[model samples]
Target: MTIVNLDHMSTNQLLPEVQKAMIEAVKKNYGNPSSQNAGGEETLGMIEKARASVAGLINCENKKEVVFTSGGTESINHGIKGVAFANTDRGKHIVTTNIEHNAVSKSIKRLSQLGYTVTSVSVNDKGMVDPADIAKAITDETILVSVMHSNNEIGTIQPIEEIAKITQEKKIILHSDAVDSVGVVPIDVQKLGVDLLSFASSTYYGPTGVGGLYVRRGVRIWPIMDGGIQEHNKRAGTENIFGIIGMGVAADLAGKNMDKRINHLKNISNFLVKELPNYIDEYHLNGDPAKGLPNLVSFAIKYIEGESIVLMLEDDGYRASTRSACATGSLRASHVLMSIGLDHADAQGTLVVTSGMENTKDDIIGFLRALKNIVKTLRDISPLYRKNQ
Candidate 1:
């Protein structure tokens, strides 16, 4: 069976160029980046090249601001926890949205246990958090504000720049979990006005297990990991050299071909949105229709569980997701869906579809056709559908 991946948010296939780069790096078998020998110096050069490339992708003015990590989770943890620990003398209060990824939420939760105060501002029905709400949540004790650049579940892009102004005026630090946004969309840290931003290589066709955290010059942040002075002392331990090389190639390609890649993704996503009604009924679109990510579509199909549909679609060679892959296997209704005003039933029935540069319009059409049948099969036996009927 030919599989169509509509779950790009979870695992993006590495680009051919990225794969080749990784293969080449492995063949070379370079030395450690920290050593002073010629082999180590060569490895260091390659690492620096990757850093510059990744920095270019996010428009970080100084490449030194970029610190490599294991992935998005570590980057977020470093950004949130590091800043929180470093700024404890200033305040123990933090601001964030209700729809943040688990990395941000759990980090803040841990901090709360350590005597820190938190104010989680809620988003509107469309999953867009108001800048005013964020401002209102801020107080004199608020030291940092960590809002995701784009929501993983619904794909709603937040107003980071507007919120950045508030943080800037108040002399508070701002961090953005841009794991899902950095490579999928154009991200300029300078323009976004964020002191710290976390991103993963997998989001941009790079290999998994390698990511970066952008710490603006002079930001008060401590290293989450302690040991070597690698990553400018922001992160410790040996780097994932193979993955970093792949990420560098992927980042460069993403920067040079972003417009073309986005166009491809937008075409398929737009087709899915425009044709969804023709294939299925009794469904509501989630997220801001006009402002969400160009490559993602979320639908709340009534009267059936999303997992049932996902499994049934998989049998038909069409893969879909019910929520963030990181939150998979959890029986609880999505906090993100609930925060966007979705009731229990609709939230449980939510389906998240994401496209990639490799996905085509026909792929989306085929998936929709498969989904229509699956939804019918599930709803035919659903007690909710029967009662509603």
Candidate 2:
């Protein structure tokens, strides 16, 4: 088979304008954004501007509410633990969904060990958490409700706006892990009604190893880490100057081109759904197709392991994944798929293909063809498939 390499989707392909911004950052490597020197003052100004840029992208009321972190995981930790610890006196109970990224899940677990009561609300077969369920689960002792805006594996977008409203009426804090939705989808912090939102730089074509948390003005959250008085004393660490600059550039680019990018992703997704199944049989789409990320498509093929199919697709030059990149190390089936009512075996066979600007119609067609051949070969060798046949 003549394979086209589609694996390793690069954000550079999505944001060519950021390259010059990154280069400029390298040339202006001044240390200690808080230093007394003029160079330091300039760096500090740049950092503040980046913060405002990020805050503006999310419709945050003020730049002071934005705190930069290393990435999504750190941002989630800050939101979960920071809120839980800061409001311990108010309550020891926290609510979140079962399908959250491990960053939020693990943070909840860590807080549980530290004597906090964590309540994990279940999602419907569409992988959406019912706002009523969240409202029902909330107790007077419930201090926070952490839900993801979208599922990374299956692309199921939760009702964060409704959830936020429910939390607010109850006078509880609502935090959303908006990493997947930040760039690919439109978000207004006020519209979403979330008190604290987490977003990653890489998801929006920014450089990796940098992310930010949006703490709505007047929301109290404790610092998860202690060190230099950076990020408005909310997060402590030397600023990632280059990465932050790249993030700002990326956010600006995304904001300007968001509508066009969304349309492109939607077109590619429609093409895949309409075409892929014609070539590949016995495949089931996962999650709510109507209410998911525009750029993400997840499906499960019977008699084929998801990871095996991903590897085969990679060999054919298609960059895809079996589940959330964070959950790649785990051998277990994806919790997201399971939450959506897929059986364990079906969930284990799930493959997620997320589109970026770099992906073309030819790319999707090539991936579909390769996937068809791979599934045929795998099914031919499988005893279960043979029996079914």
Candidate 3:
């Protein structure tokens, strides 16, 4: 039985190499990284090496600027909340887009509850946010601007570099949730000019429980967590030694093969774009195909449920997602699709297919065949389809 995995954005399978690294980290260097003993020093070296790998993948100039965290959610919280709490005197306003991942959106919502003002700029019909809107949203009281480098749901790549210039000109802080972009795209924090960036380890086939936030050198953001001196007192707790080691290896490996992986994703996704719409009538691609992430292809079918399609794919041993994994069990329609001007019915029929390193052409064809059949069967029975007919 050949099973095609299309849900890599939610999580990734741990690579064999990453597993080996994690084992070596625990077995050979299992000591508290904070300890002054020799084992601790060895453990510290391993962790730093991993940090360097993450730095290399993201083109971060200094490893110390990378602070380890639990995962993407935590990194975003630290970056947004850290700056919001630390810079209240500077300004109480923040700017972001309407289509941010739940992490950034929810974090800003919390900030608003704390009396910090928030302006959620809108995205155009193509699912792209304009730099002009971001600039317009900024004001004297605006202390920070956060944006996603690339959207996970629709694969729309935001203009972070341009937005960064706006923030830099005003001396305001810019934070990017690059959890979906760091391992997949060529990220150079220097070029992006972002003050803070967050990405999860699992995005690159590393362990699930670890990730990091890159706080550009000399950026003064308050610590969200406190108790220990870990993460240079920016975050405090015992580090996930094994997970860090695995993430470091994954980051290094991603840097080594990023071009190859990206090209593969594009090739496969292009195939999907050309053939997918042919099978289902009134189906539309969701994002800007040329500029979006190469790995993801999302679409909407008329008068159908996304969940039914996902379940049918799963029954055939393929995995797909209707929305972000974080939003599972919530019956609400995707906010992303709605923001891009999709009505509730159009958004309800949304289907997202995200490619990964392991998928083959045969897998793609098979998935498409199954999808066409399922959509036909579903629409054939749908009362709405009959009424429209």
Q: Write the per-residue lDDT of candidate 3 for residues 1-389, one digit (tens) a residue.
A: 66689998888899999998888766784899999999888888888999999988888889898999999999999999999999888989999999999999999999899999999999998789999999999999999999899999899999999999999999999999999998998999999999999999999899998999999988879999988898878999989999999999999899999999999999989988887766668887898877899999889989889999999999988899988999888888999999999999889999999989899888888898898899988999999888888
Model 3 error, position 17 (Å): 1.1
lDDT of 2 at 227: 88
**How many residue-pair clashes does candidate 3 contain?**
0
Give the Å error, residue 384, model 3.
1.4
Instruction: Quote the positional error of residue 287 for candidate 2 in Å.
Output: 1.0
Q: Where does model 2 exceed 4 Å of error?
A: 1-14
lDDT of model number 3: 0.91
After superposing candidate 3, which stretches have Cα over 4 Å from the reference?
A: none
Candidate 1, poorest ten consecutive residues by summed lDDT: 288-297
lDDT of each: 0.93, 0.84, 0.91
Please give the distance, in angstroms, between residue 258's alpha carbon in candidate 1 and its true position after superposition.
Answer: 0.7
Reference-based TM-score of each model:
0.99, 0.96, 0.98
Per-residue C-alpha lDDT of model 1 across residues 1-389, encoded as one tens digit per residue: 88988899997888998999999999999999999999999999999999999999999889999999999999999999999999989999999999999999999999999999999999999899999999999999999999999998998999999999999999999999999998888999999999999999999899999999999999999998899999988888998899999999999999999899888888888888899999999999999756889888998999999998989989999888999999999999999999999999999999999988778888888888888888888988999999999
